[model samples]
Target chain A: MSRHVIGVLVENQPGVLNRVSGLFSRRGFNIDSISVGVTERSDVSRMTLTLDGDEKVLEQLTKHLNKLPDVIKVTHLDAGCVERGLALVKVDVSSPESRSEVMQVADVFRGAVIDVSRDTVTVEVTGTEDKIQAMLDLLREHGIKEVARTGVAAMARGPKYTGTE
Target chain B: MRNGCDVVLESFDAEGVDTVFGYPGGAIINLYDTLYDADLNHVLTRHEQAAAHAADGYARATGEVGVCLSTSGPGATNLVTGIATAHMDSVPILAVTGQVPTGMIGNDAFQEADVTGITMPITKHNYLVQDADELPGVMREAFFLANTGRPGPVVVDLPKDVQTAETDVEYPSVDDVKRGIRGYSPTYGGHPRQVKRAAEAISGADRPVVYAGGGVIASGASRELRRLAEITGAPVTTTLMGLGAFDERDPLSLGMLGMHGTKAANYAVTESDLLIAVGARFDDRVTGKLDAFAPNATVIHIDVDPAEISKNVEAHVPIVGDAGDVLGELNSTLEEMAVRDGSEWREKVKRWKREYPLDYEESDDVIKPQSVVEAINQHSPEDTVIATEVGQCQMWAAQFFDYTKPRSLVSSGGLGTMGYGFPAAIGAQVGRPGATVWDVAGDGSLQMNIQELATVALNDIPVKVAILNNGYLGMVRQWQELFFGERYSSTDLDQVPDFARVAESYGVKGVTVERPSEVEDAVREALEHDGPVVLDFRVAREENVFPMVPAGAAINEILEG
Candidate 1:
């Protein structure tokens, strides 16, 4: 099964998310990550959706969703399009030597130390899905206390938005 | 003399608008200015939401598209909920909203909240007039869209600039209206093969029960449903929305099913070998534990909405169509098959009804909601239209009101909005002037829109309002008592106003009933009143609607009081 990412452009309004999620829920489809935010146009908002489903079901779902009133347009982006996920990892910084070691790994991954205290250091990283996972793997050796990641907020590779006048 | 607002006002007049309900603001002031000089009358609703609902009620009662106007921003947003409610119930309403100027479209204009975008989900269709020239076409389309198809609310957002902009307006042709939309799709009904299949299933079954719902009323198929039940000798059970679809007094009627449904109704649904669900959505509230609901039954679901077919409980023989058309077809098919009454099925249903009956303790003091419903039936004309707000009173009205005719009773069946009845009653009264229209409401629900008393009085609509003032949101409190540790929270409503004074302020006669003896007189006085009247009956607050089966529980294990 090929993992696919789909970006949905919709008119931002109350119950639009509910409608989109409801479509998935009713079809018994498990969504991986969904992020909704305002687009360049104030009237419209773009929803970046990640889910696993049969290709035929996804195709049918996209058409059904377009049939809803508020849904303006939907686009299924290919792997060539650059998409990034943001993640923040907070790990224990108990040992003095490991702190530098974690910082070295963070520097390699282009991750920033967002917050630092004697017991813990919170690293913020933003990149494609694999890069974020790699940063987490390196930080895990230092015994991570907690992690909070914004669930897959995404956009297209170049100057292209699904919503237009 | 040649103002753009006048053009719009004249168009409304031509479209047959006798009355409109709305609260005017700065954006709509120009339209109101034109209305003031014109013969068109407008009722100043306290809230824009009420105006929308009032328009919805008016539409439902009259079968014409209801019209409401509100200013931009909050005024438009307030109308959203009511619009959604009307859409949910499939009532035709045309909402006119004022928006900021076309130039001030997206600059965060004051009193502007993108009403067209916000209402897209709620409305069947909406139009935002960017050009003044587009106003006539939009208005014409709004009316057509609302009144046609499944009948739902439509909105036309008139910018202040557009309302005040001078332009030559021409109404669009009907062909132009249907160009973009496929409005001619027929709602589902009986197909020949499915009707034959249903008849065969019914005849072959050992025990069969007819589970009817609100769609029966919408389809105007109550008599047909009853006929099918009688012919098959299958006892009838109704969901909360399905109450009046069956005659409550009929011997074969097992009363309401689901949570708060009668023991017999629930028992019949559970034990029946063949479950025939007509015009009913198997709501979780009705089905309880879906796996356990109608366990032994080979369900045959017949509904208008394709989505409702096999959405919840799977149907062995699914028929998506109008209830009237399908039931009529099924009857003909049954006649062809020469299907006779199954004596064993009839005997089982009768035994269930006799053993676990719809029972309520007779109290000589406090006024029972059941008694109030019955009294309304006896006092009012048979053709009188009764609209009930949600809660215990809604259930009681659905149970006790004898609706031998179609569309005689209006209710917030799908959404169950609390404050629906008062405005709906006003709309009903206006729609059917000679018919006695009564808004049967619980105190908590009535207070939500008791302000509509003013609309009633001002319009001289004279709709009788019966408030079963139990001093609590009876339905919720009933649940708390049954499910929770009986620790009633926000349900208890105390320090109520003198309702008589409230009614008097609105220039309507008010009657109060405390004792059971006063019930008859109060209802009688309310009925006889020349204008709008309020009968506030301070009935039992703690009286729970009985025969309630908690959700997910077996239908047979009902909580009877």
Candidate 2:
């Protein structure tokens, strides 16, 4: 029942996401979220997956994943890290007062104004899962229109590094 | 100077590796690019999971550290199950994946995923490369960790930029590499006193039985196990995971004891006066009721893993060491001591086998799994390599197949991973091409990696696949029928693909059998084919694997056929 977040470093290529996700599915592992993107290295990519299993299962899974030919490195991220996700929430700006209230709430969370229309305003918030939830909660009072959220992605905090393989 | 991926590969080649299996993905593209022109060769699998299993099979077959590659996100995650399988089976393998570049790592950048943190618990050791310079050392260290100690899988995660970045390469020799796992040495020979005690116990017992397991094969102690059995004149019963450790046809053999085991096998375990358990974990499936299991017996256990000692059934004498080495010492000690034959005990076991022999009804209306297995035995070569997937087929393989050579029967015994047979057969074929390799799988298990037929075709490996197509998750269905009043739920696989078409799609020849008479002909044709082939036989679905002891029931409570 121990949950874990694994930070994976890989080369950017097609079908990689499916390959990783399918693995979890086939083994009947419950994966909460998987976030992927390009990194500072244009050719490389990073993915963070949150999954839960026992110590023995985790040990076996990690070793098996490392054996893949395309994988460059797989790191099980430590909990002592600043983990975060990005989300965009669109609120119904039916009135001028509603738009102002939304702006005030976004400002409180340090969220940026991404898009706006006569009847709607989209605020992009980047922070910890709790922070994003807070912003979403505040905006929900103003009648939420739509939301798109990037799944949780994390990294170690401070000068600490997982180290390169 | 070397990038992370280049550094990893160079280190692997230095480690004397020639082959790796993987699938390319966003995060791992850079590594594949570097590997393409590198001295190391890579087998591009359709799925990352298959790559991991292939590596596992390679490791199991060759005793070499197998390697696999995948990209970030799903690519990295896909290798998890395969890695877990290898770990459970104690196979050595290395999985490498590429990660997002340093700056955009957690920005939800396209195709980025954290592999290392996800795989921590599944691997022996895992490394995430934050610096390019450490790549070579990490790869070397990964290999060392994988192959040494209690051999298992290790992981290395590399960032893309780091792989392409320049760094000085410092390759470490095999002997120079340092490993972190403690007390993991595969060769832990037991002390002399332990052997003497074990020998004395064996000699003194009136009704002794040698319970052999895969440890005998892993320790290369099959010959020693045989010698011990012959010297003591004790009949041997095996765990499901221990099949083929002793010759199945040997007169002293009691096939697969415990739950779902032969009645004679189970009875022998419970009735024996002394139980010599070797290289076995005393798994619940084997013990059934730990309290009642071998209740009348004085147990002497020998295993490589110390943790396994006294973890399940309490042992009167526990010796932790390599099964072969310790058994060898025990054999020498027995030769020196005055040990008498237990003819009465042997006769009792023989009587048990005769009284409740393993049997299955076969009529013209249905193709029973037992009949299929018997046909396989009738047709297979003397040194045939038969790999079975888990469930009914695996049990049948254990019961029916006569394995004269060690490693002749490869199956997911401990882990019981479904779809293990096909990839393992390919690996076995690669290891021993002269031996006739057959992947005998049930329909439920075969579909797990049915796509591996393409691997066979692509690699030109002529391993034959025998599908016991019972149109259901046979084992689970059988359990439901026997225990759950036959209220089948999601057990029936009515939506199975046309196996022939599926095989043809992969460019492999496919043969179908509807009658029992056609079984031999289909198998023979597949064996004769110059390339990979699949023989799908429509076996009866309701056929239960017999001689089953209900979970936690005493060994004596075996339900016979």
Candidate 3:
């Protein structure tokens, strides 16, 4: 199965998120990750869903999503679209050497040290999923403590937009 | 300034809704008070589930949006099964529910429930109205959503405060409501290219079968379906929900198809080279063993719901549009093509029909359920509407009834909810007062909603109920006998109350028939009665519906008795 990202525009109303997520669970469609936020129009909200499925499954998923009354539009983001995810990773730095090493790794990835305690440091990273995963892999030796991630957010590369009038 | 309850009634009037089935409760008391002076007819069902089912029945019979109302919490919860049944069958129904006061909504107030959340999966759309001004618009949108493309149930939950909250907002016109819901435009016409391809597929096939379903009836496309069948000279088979979409008495008709489907219909579908599916989803019940179903047939599926096009079985040419419009296009397109002659295929289907006709053994000691069905069909008027509780009785009704028009057969097809028929028959009788309405019920299924007998007797609905009393949950017993080594379990309902006496207790006429000879006469007498009547036929206890395709087996794997 190939991984795919779908962008959906829906009415900004109560229980709209439950409607979308409930549909996926009920239909037995596995959701890898999903992110929702306000769009350019206040009345419309945008949701980015990342999932793994073959062509037919993707088509069916889109069709099912389109059937929701609150959904304004659903578009599959292809390779031309830019996708990004944000992650905040906390790592234990037992020594000064380890702190420098972690700092070096974060520097290479252009991650900001958002917080620093006596024994640990929190690094804020934002990039494509692959970049964030690579940074996390390097931080594993530093004894990762906790990580919070914002699922993939995608937008078409060109002037094309999914918006309600 | 008008209250929200006034807006609800005005919206109903604007939508041309004449009847609503519901029971008044604390949260919904204000709406009931508003209804007191309204000209609309409100059927006071014994239970909330019965009210929902009755509304569903009204929708199925009249092809309009059926409406039901209930109070908060338990009242709304009780409508779950009925709503799910309508959802599964794509029946258009609007469920209006009253919630606790807005301030106490999430504070664990008395009779409070998150009804909108509970009904999200089962409804086409729903709204928890917060402001009284939105009441008028929500009502219009709710009714529109319920009856529109791929119709299903819609819920509008109004908090008790909202019902009494006064607002100056006027009920919107139909166009205003349409403009508000911009995301719900349904495709009514099939793509021209796909229609052409479907026509080509139909014309090129050597063996073809027209498989119609409830969508045909929903779209009022029976005439178009008949035209397509005649133009192609293909035999027509229907899903249980599709009964009456094509006249069963027609020479080209192959009764019902699927689990309890006729042998000839199953055989025809298995061998056909082309399967033209119109407004019918390839449900698991209809397509037993999906990988092996219609193995050789190139499928052309026409349905209004895009999700249903290739949901189960892949369609070679999928036409996403209303059945009537798509079928109309297909017929016109086929008229231009050089169609294949299906005379040989027709003859083969006819031979199958002749060789495997539905039959049951004659018994003198007890009545045969099939004979009871035949008696009802023979005695009832041609235009009689036959509703049925789910199980062997439902299948028998579908099998034996001579349905010549759409909406003549109203049974729970998808959800298979027992106790659906009795209340549904009341709704049908209310919807079509001039036509005879019969609920052919199983003993166990009838008892599920037997309390509706009070509804019938009180309303004076002239609905005739014929009970096939087998002293067991007959369908489950059949499965147990066939698949579970006859372990019986809880299926043998030996303590079933005498249905005739039950009807009499409700102030309705009741009759009990034990002999086969009495079946027809009892049905005639019940029809001749001016009020509601229940006829209980003590059918053979172990009678099993035959030509059954065991669950998960291929359709061709028929089990004949």
Q: Per-residue CA lDDT of candidate 3, range B113-170, in tens?
A: 8999999999999999999999999999998888889999999999999999999998
Report how far off residue B481 is in candidate 2 (Å): 0.9
**Winner by DockQ:** 3
> How would you class the docking of model 3?
high
Interface RMSD of each: 6.3, 11.0, 0.6
Give the CAPRI rating of model 2: incorrect
Residue-wise lDDT of candidate 2 within B406-489, one digit each (tens)? 677777766678878887777667766687888888888989888887888898888888888888898888888888999899
TM-score per prediction, in order, is: 0.77, 0.75, 0.99
Q: Which stretches of candidate 3 lie over 4 Å from their true place?
A: none
lDDT for model 1? 0.79
Best by TM-score: 3
Q: What is the lDDT of residue B153 in candidate 1?
A: 87
DockQ of 1: 0.06
Error of 3 at B312 (Å): 0.8
For A1-165, candidate 2 gives per-residue lDDT tens digits of 787888877657554565566566655667777899888777667888777787656665665455443456778885687788899999999966999999999999999999999999999999977799889998998999999998788888789765333
Give each model's whole-structure lDDT.
0.79, 0.79, 0.93
TM-score between model 3 and native: 0.99
